[model samples]
Target: MSQGKLSPRQKMINLMYLIFIAMLALNMSKEVLSAFGLLEKKITNANVATSERNVAFMESLSTMALEQPEQYAAVKRKADQVSEISATLDAYLGDIKRQMMTTLKAEDFEDFEVQDQPDFLDQR
Candidate 1:
């Protein structure tokens, strides 16, 4: 039967089919999945690096407390500020990563090669 003449049950089935097709399309698109994986990996690495740095900083703080009690409080205060800044930076990086992923089209990840000369100026 024509779509215009479809009953309620047929319409519902058609809607479901559309949704299923859309989901399949998304899953089959390598660019979309690659983008998702790239962003997820970056976030995981960032968390790992942050944890490692914080652990090292805490160790240094303990050593400082034993060797230089006077500067310990100052170091602790600066560490707190640094931690806050790191958190903000992480959030900003996450947002940028997500935006880039969403904005990238299928052609963007086709080659997936880094430039010969990486842009150091873009780091900041």
Candidate 2:
């Protein structure tokens, strides 16, 4: 009740306020992590679909080349070059992804967000 001193109730209220702030921080961290997980899963799915489409595109090119070598020979050569370059780039990206996983000490990014490893929120 005095200006210089906090009463017991005031002290308890302050402690509760701090605890509430901490809990809010923890909840916000979880929400951020869940958002990141959702984004990662979307990117992963897009990469997979793109890779599959690339393979199918090359396969179709090869078939066309075989069916009409005179008309599609150049297409086949370009397809081979594209495939080689894609493989090289994919390997490089895979290496980077591996390093990221190792840094996080995570075996795999789960499809769903996990509340664990809240420290990952600090990586930024």
Candidate 3:
């Protein structure tokens, strides 16, 4: 429709339609951004909760090892390694989330409607 010159009224209608489409796109983008922000927040919260539970489990394992080395030393060592790896991974993921939020200048997921962390797809 925009390939060549056209009548003034047709051009006006095309411009108006383009503007309407742009408005719709803007609204959709905001909705999509809100959804992504909500998802990110949920994942982050889940990670924190899981990490906390893992830490507690590791502590209990350490206590068991202290109480009975013959049985739990190996188990505790394995648990320690698992905890280390999980902690490292959680830290890395948390850092990425923080960086994304910072880059987008978005508010914490505490408020979803205002979040702008919609650029999470960029691997950079």
lDDT per model, in order?
0.70, 0.77, 0.76
As for TM-score, the candidate ahead, 1 or 2, is 2
Best by lDDT: 2
Poorly placed runs, candidate 2 (over 4 Å): 1-33, 107-124
Estimated TM-score for each candidate: 0.38, 0.57, 0.57
Over 46-100, each residue of candidate 3 has an lDDT whose tens digit, in order, gives 9789878877988888898999999999998888787788779978987986776
Q: Please give, for residues 1-124, the per-residue lDDT of candidate 1 as tens digits.
A: 4646878998899899999999987554546556766886798889899899888987889788778879797877787788889889979987875655444455653343321112433443
Inter-residue clash pairs, candidate 2: none
Q: How do the residues 1-124 of candidate 2 rate in per-residue lDDT, one tens digit apiece?
A: 3589898999999999999999987665556777888887899899999989988988898899999999999989987988899899989988876655554534445633453554533574
Off by over 4 Å in 3: 1-29, 106-123
Q: On a 0 to 100 scale, what is the lDDT of residue 108 in model 1?
A: 57
Give each model's clash number.
0, 0, 0
Q: Model 3 Cα RMSD, Å?
A: 8.1
True-vs-predicted CA distance for residue 29, candidate 2, Å? 6.3
